[model samples]
Target: MNETVLYEKAGAVARVTMNRPRVHNAQSRVLLEGLDEAFAEAMADHDVRAVVLFGAGPHWSSGHDIGTPEELADRDARPYRPGADGHHQRSWDWNVENTMRWRDLPKPTLAAVHGMCIYGGWMIASAMDLIVAADNAQFLPFLFQYQSTPWDIGARRAKDIMWEQGLLTAEDAHRLGFVSQVCTPADLDEVAMAKAHRIAALNPLLAQMIKRQVNDAQDAMGFRTAIAAGHSAYMIANLGHAFFDAENPFGSRKKMPGIDEARERAERTK
Candidate 1:
């Protein structure tokens, strides 16, 4: 934890906080690398029986850092996976592979969600073992990498919240089994720590067995496959931006409303 992430330890619970409050904790490469190191630290510590993820801002996150000046610089300098294609390779590493790795982490992990949890926020929170959300929190998704919404909240509920750029309140998410508990904003931290304390009290091996037992069942039901396929579908859409006919091959949503004509057409769709 450096400038972007804050790592704190209390007894057996490790709190990993996203610290980019100015931009609603937008995930820049600096933040992601710091977050990875924090998680790794928690994973290696024998005394840390439970981990909690928090955001330090008005919202948990506004989603991926969509081309901020600092983020663009970091993206250019970040190394790509050696054998893998470099196009968005870093994105795949942090949001997909790392997310899944956190999902399978041996110890109990919890997300204390408050404010707006957008697309990229979902990538982090949904990877946790449990979630404690503030009543006012918003759960929004626009199909970012490693989309596990369908697995987290059943196929039907996933479609309801995601089919049309929709969102769910924390209460609705709790009802749908996505959030473990919903608390007042003032009590969110205390509630999350209380649960983490309970988890830490349990025998570590017992805790891990329970985690793996449930995840193995989920995996058996094709959770991993569905997640990979969801990202594949997302990329297809990301680069599938076009005007009328299929013209632009490498165009992305970043280039959407590309030309004057395309901007006019986009307005019409609105």
Candidate 2:
């Protein structure tokens, strides 16, 4: 694959690394497309029974590309997805369609996230079956894209994130049952790889069945319906005046809370 994404295999597990350190692995259309190809590669390989996603450089991801030069170039020159027309289809293709496809992959998937796991980063990690974050990771898991707030961390906490623009610490995420485990940055990969191998070693059929069972339970609770509704709202926001708040009377939003505090706390403790 292109340098935007690196794919490798170790025994029974496949590792997919997002490779844009300069931009903190921002989710350019090319990068996301490459990631999907890498995941498909792992799934096609019989020897690969599990997958682990990682990001290159200091941060896992800064979030979706906010008009980066590279991203703009791709939009001008390359096709995002074949036959993906209009805002709705394109948004559904990347944000919902591809996301759920990976989520439903028969093999188990894990994401080892570190640094800034912001909105889009959180969305990517949420697609995986298990998320093992570094203790120093900071999460801004807001209701965006897939709109996985309630399913990932419950409705009340999701509201707290929106109301206060909350930043999520690794400890807080673990306590809220969002992150499956938290480890030091030094041990993050090892811990995630171990989990991948352990799952890979299990009976493959049983593993797939277990995944389906849990996901089915969530779907029964209207997980997919809620996500669809959220996506519709997000598209509407894109169309008209959105993100306007009474507190920001200057036509510009104020700085978010918990950014400095969360970084300092994670740094000092680490």
Candidate 3:
């Protein structure tokens, strides 16, 4: 497993922490692989009845470390020898795979979110069965315009967070249905641990059966299709020279198109 993910189990509860404070816990290829391995271990562990997913340091995660569109363009402009493996494709593939594995885990899982839960971080929480958010935590889904894809699971969840109603406050999320519960930063750990313990006390056989029933129902109804539609509809970022560069063309604090605008343009183009 990659060093970016830390896995430990206590009795029937498993804890998975994203351990990259340097990048604000950004989701890199290494972290993605580690998460995959950890999730697999959790699935195979019969003794574990629940999982607690959280991040180390102050924040949860930012998102992919793509630097900026300018960086992509710079790389595209230069003549470079192709690697044996398709790194770009693998990045996307690994993210989707590991994220889905967590989402589809048979046992219950909770995301203990604090600090800056933005972009990919938001998606990770949305994928879990339950979310326990701290009052100081801010969930931001500001990546709808940077890629051209549709109907992805992450995109669907992002839409609800960014639009549907609006960016959710901890209270709003509880009211709007994304958040399972909200607590203060000081009490977040206690609340999350208590919830996981409650879940762990449930009959593991019945809990897993119920979990699978819910996921299987979604799959039967073509959940991935809807996700793809959402992704395609909202992610209208074209792979152009502006977006492909070697360095971040847009500086750190730059603002690009938001979800509504990107969705509109994508729909119009279609």
Candidate 4:
């Protein structure tokens, strides 16, 4: 347990919390490291049969912070260094690794989402077996807000959620099977905890086998190829000249026709 994340176990359940409320639970390198530690501990704890992930305050998570301009400049100025192990995983590895672990956890996992679930946060939630969203909880991939791209899995999932399918509502997500259940903010934890208890009651060995099988099936689907391509494309598009053009070209990339008055006028029964 660290200041950035809270980890605790009760009976058969392990609970992990994103503790940075002021930033809407947005992750930095330190928060990501905390998540890794929390997941590792829960995985090794014999008493844990299920994991529940939630944030401490209003938001589920807002995704990775871009940092201040000064901080970004400092990062660009720093030299890359190899670790004693002869390989240094980048800072983003913490987020990527933990989300993968959640998706592959031998025991069942649940996400209790409140306020915002944007970008990287949505990726983490998508990795879980079950999602319980509050009525007001928003799943904003926020692809529209960033100048830079998300991590690999995040981009793929966001595309599927926001682009390939038009699941713009919490009800739409429920209908499309993105979220397993919906409830009010006050009742979200109750629903998630109840689901976790039911899952925990199942045979842990059987649960583990089923989880591994799911991952095996995904591996057969060229999941790795899709993830790599999506990540590379996102980064290249964001880092290229278009991202910094005077007109802010990416702002017009949103295809939600009904959202803009100009687009609505263009489609006026003509």
Candidate 5:
């Protein structure tokens, strides 16, 4: 729908590619809107039985486009009232509502992840019905934003991941049941497309029903509720960042000393 995202259909499989390679396909508001439109188009096409989402670069996504002032300003200029609270609420709504919408899409969806799948990117991958990660892919919740690690990867492992600020290799993700499969970078696209096509070959109605059943099982375990609660916590955390972390108020408080420093601190504590 937009230059930020590309959509194509091959048989019953629809592919949505995030196209901002230079910025590691960072999630700017424009990019997010484009993604929504692409997914909506695929969902509305009756011929499309499955969807594949991936980035068109060395990395899937680094995270949100926090450093782009022009993009941020454009996003802020939207109908929303301008202020810290307004910004926080808007972000919370967008991230939670859109992700949940994608998660519940009737057709099965697969995410092909590689390189940096961190922060908001992690949330995107977690929402997909299945994930096919390149061997070089690394999953990091990047804890500087909303935390969905527990719901996505289970409680104990989530704790271990956050405690260590861990970079989860594809094999580690598969072992933890977070990734459906892992492939070499060169084979990632083929592997993901094959899986999508295979799933598409199944009775589409039954496939949708099966996906709903599994999601319902997860909901029964309070998965959706937990994510909502995390969103609330994320808001509170932002308030802290705005009030206490004055230097970068309205931004991630975890910004200081950078990710490397944070990881080193985590390793030392471990």
Candidate 6:
């Protein structure tokens, strides 16, 4: 099978690139597993102090590959069968548990994003320690349909994004504190790698402690609890979509106008 993720070491920094460029690095079962393995590998490597996650394509990610039935079947056969505990539990596992694992990693992680970062893409980026976006990047929080919004970009902004089907420019994301920095498209890699190297140069133990302290502070404020609450609501929303709004099942069906269409419609109304 073709590799869905590529891993490389540069000095103390480990780079993990989502490799399915043809599909804009959409997360299929293999791709998700590949990411898990890549993260694990980076964590295990003593030489690695920081990790950079990005996509090897024009776009960062198109989000989850819901249309790939073969990949879905292959994923179900894997040990982490997300659906093993039923659909709701499965959502928690895939969307919450797995992402949290990466979020709580001991070392710092940076996401270098450009082009389209949608739905699941936003989920992964939000879990990272920092996000560096290319000037041309646009973020779509389409997971609003799944009821996961407020925590990533704050409450009032989330409402606007979801209600209007808005696309956030890199500048807007930076102002909202979702993106740490924004660089020109041509300089994205250089800027992100420089930040990674700077972090890698720090004492790994101290770096980890710093990360833990910040995460702990957030957790103390019920960040995790809020996410869990969102997941519960997400489960209900998903069931409604699956049964009643078949045309827009998880925002993946072609029968639906999709985010691009929704964005246009929202624009016209304005």
- Give the whole-model CA lDDT for all candidates, comma-separated: 0.81, 0.83, 0.67, 0.64, 0.82, 0.80
Model 5 whole-model lDDT (C-alpha atoms): 0.82
So what's the TM-score on candidate 6?
0.88
TM-score of 2: 0.88
Query: Regarding TM-score, does 1 or 4 come out ahead?
Result: 1
TM-score top scorer: 5
Measured by TM-score, how close is model 5 to the native structure?
Answer: 0.90
lDDT of 4 by residue, 149-259 (tens): 233224455556444323234565576567788898889878888888788888999888887887777768765555555544544554445443435443222222221
TM-score of each: 0.87, 0.88, 0.74, 0.75, 0.90, 0.88
Write down the worst ten-residue block by lDDT for model 5: 253-262
* RMSD list, candidates in order: 5.0, 4.9, 7.2, 7.2, 2.7, 3.4
If the candidates were sorted by their lDDT against the true structure, best first, what order would they fall in? Answer: 2, 5, 1, 6, 3, 4
| Candidates 1 and 3 compared by TM-score, better number | 1
User: What is candidate 4's CA lDDT for residue 25?
Assistant: 80
Which wins on lDDT, candidate 5 or candidate 6? 5
lDDT of 3 by residue, 28-123 (tens): 656777887887898899888899998998877766555444335644674234541333334336555466667788889999988766666766
**Once model 5 is optimally superposed onto the true structure by TM-score, how far is the C-alpha of residue 61 displaced, in angstroms?**
0.9
lDDT, residue 268, candidate 1: 51
lDDT of 2 at 51: 99
lDDT: the better of candidates 2 and 5: 2
Using lDDT, give the best candidate's number: 2
Candidate 4: count the clashes.
Answer: 0
Cα lDDT of candidate 3 equals 0.67
Write candidate 2's Cα lDDT for 9-51 as tens digits.
9999999999999888888888889998999899889999999
